[model samples]
Target: MFSPDALIASAKRTISLEQDAISSLLARIDDSFVRACELILNCKGRVVVVGMGKSGHIAHKIAATLASTGTPAFFVHPAEASHGDMGMITADDVVLALSNSGTTNEIVTLLPLIKRLGLTLISMTGNPDSTLANAAQVNLDTQVSKEACPLNLAPTSSTTVTLVLGDALAIALLEARGFTPEDFAFSHPGGALGRRLLLKVEHVMHSGDELPAVTRDASLRATLLEMTQKGLGMTLILAPDRTLAGIFTDGDLRRALDKGIDVREANIAELMTHGGKTARPEMLAAEALKIMEDHKISSLPVVNENNQAIGALNMHDLLRAGVM
Candidate 1:
């Protein structure tokens, strides 16, 4: 078996080579890259990505990234395209073709059809003078000095550079389109990121009679009863006019007990924490989570414009809603 130190050294060398390959791409982001972006930007239909072998895998990822970031794109296997999937392509669309050697037969076979259909063709290839590059309206140079594999046969450095170039294209389009977090959330509605961006405090808060609340003059024992009934680990203390006065939590109760304060006789006002952190209904649930984390609290009172407690939320609520 290979020694751990030797394995580590080999891995480091591979990473360094790939890093150099990516760094070299900085200088290659020329007018051709700009033209490719413009072609996709002006395209009326989706971007159809096609490739073969390892390049096909990279093409699939590029298509997905483009789709999620405001550009409509999908991957079609070149072999499938030659058979019948070519019907999915339209004149208004743009074709993004990838091939490391710029001579993948499957992809090369579809070039004439793509041109005949009058679709804009963009190629990402290692050889700038190859047939695919010559046929493309814009050729993105994804050339690398050498493969990171010891045998120099595997698709390592070339694939890395191609993936990075695809990312550059997707993000450039994303910024050009002014795609917002809300727009991204719509694309990833079931993920944690979507929950953080789309969920509001109002969506996860307990409202109306479910709010564990009592007037400021209520006894500490009464506040504890409300907290127990609501199971939110806290109670909101409101003033006579229904405005927020303070908050009393399980932590406060523990401290009051440690200080020998009698829960039955103590006024809730004297035992509560004054002017605690508040949440707005329209505020992002992620933002409310930040407040709770910063203050080291487990709950927050959702207040209206007049500072009246309208709802309440706890850590459990955020966890249940996948906002945590």
Candidate 2:
């Protein structure tokens, strides 16, 4: 019995309402917000986030964002805290409590004990005048004009605003700490982002015997054999003293065939590209990929400080390492 048009209309209205709620939050980033950030920034211990029901879900996400961005944080359900989880909070910790109505019984019940422990209390609530806000040292107002739900009972727009506010707080703290991409990579070492930011050419490139190389005076036939044996689509051309002279790739082979050059007799130095694009062992794998893409090449030779080819890598290596 549901109409498609009605469903689309309801979805659009919900999005629009949530957008307005977030927009309203921009003006609410007052001194209280700054105070809350300062408390968390100065805390010697971790941030302890507590909420009930829908707020608890948002609290969990906020805690994750904070932890990943250089802040130590964890979420504790308000009801669970009442049972036995209250032991998790220490005097040095900062408590970040969330309640839309600011009257969540479970959270409210913990306020007395929180005060006794001398922990810094920061509250995010939709009701500015609620008991939770009054009991906190600093209060963040996440008030929304109305719920996105037509019934006005569901925590729709209010939850969206709260989540956005939490993100804003996390980003502010991250910037305050001067968090860098490498710092982020350390926290997410198992993810694709970690590979892109942390994995270096030395970590994935073919080195030692696996690196394909041929002297500049070597015949094209021998260079092709090295390429085939290495399967890197390219071979590094080294001078007599073992320094990088040039590079020969499949593209050069194709051009040689087009010109009808004699592969058996032609020297690799004559056809090789001089001082071709190269990567450093310490360079990020993603940077090597970018260089390959910019030059429209498939392989890169990793060079040392002395300009000697120490390793080799190709697009396939990047793909296999999850750096693509």
Candidate 3:
């Protein structure tokens, strides 16, 4: 059996090796890297990434990062390309090939066809002098001095370096293209970030008949009934002209009871909070959430410029909408 101390030491050694490999890449971001970015930025067609074995897995991830970060890219297996997928390549597209030794047979076999199609080629390889690197218009060198594996044969440090380099390239291009959070949200509409950025108060708030409101002169008992009917734990107190006068919540009821006021006879205007925090219909749900959190409140009344309550939303609505 392996000793605990030995396993910990081995893990630490692997981490140190990979960390050093990543640090070395900082010095290699030179003119070649700039040229590669220029080529991909100017390409009229999507980036077609191809690799074999372990490199292929990294290539797939790189392609996804590129696509989500404003660059159109997809991965194609080198072996599949040789069989029939080569047809996916167009003259307008750019090819990004990956190989550690820069001599992946499956990829090398497609060189002639790539050249014949006159497509611009970019390669990420460990060997600058290898065939794949030499054939590219620009090459990103991801050479690592040694593998993190004790045997020095596994694709450990090398793969990590390649992944970091790919992320660097994607981020550089994203900045060059002036990618924004809204642009990113478009690509990730189903994710939490997207929900926070894209969902507005109008999309999740209870509006129209769903709004709980009562005239300011109404009894605390009537306000309670409206709150229960709307199921928002609160109700808006409106003026005769429909403008907001105040708000009543469960907390207000507790305070009233503490003051020895009878619920059936107490006036809502005296017990309610005067025009508490409000949200707008077009406001982002995230912004509304911030308001609720900052005030330590659980509900918000959506009001227009004239202070008319048009809608209402509680923490539960945001939770159900995945905006919380």
What's the lDDT for residue 25 in model 1? 99
lDDT of 2 by residue, 153-233 (tens): 999999999999999999999999999999999999999999899999999999999999999889999999999998889
Displacement of the residue 155 alpha carbon in candidate 1, Å: 2.4
Candidate 1 off by > 4 Å: 1-13, 258-262, 265-267
Top TM-score model: 3
lDDT per residue (tens digit) for residues 185-243 in model 3: 99999999999999999999998889999998898888898989989999999999889
Root-mean-square deviation of every model: 2.5, 1.7, 1.6
- Distance (Å) between predicted and true CA of 214, model 2? 1.7
Write out the backbone clash pairs for model 2.
none
Q: How accurate is candidate 1 locally (lDDT)?
A: 0.95
Runs of candidate 2 exceeding 4 Å displacement? none
Q: State TM-scores per candidate.
A: 0.89, 0.94, 0.95
Model 3 worst lDDT window (10 residues): 262-271
Return the TM-score for candidate 2, rounded to 2 decimals: 0.94
Top candidate on lDDT is: 1
How much is the lDDT of residue 223 in candidate 2? 93
Query: CA lDDT, every prediction?
Result: 0.95, 0.94, 0.94
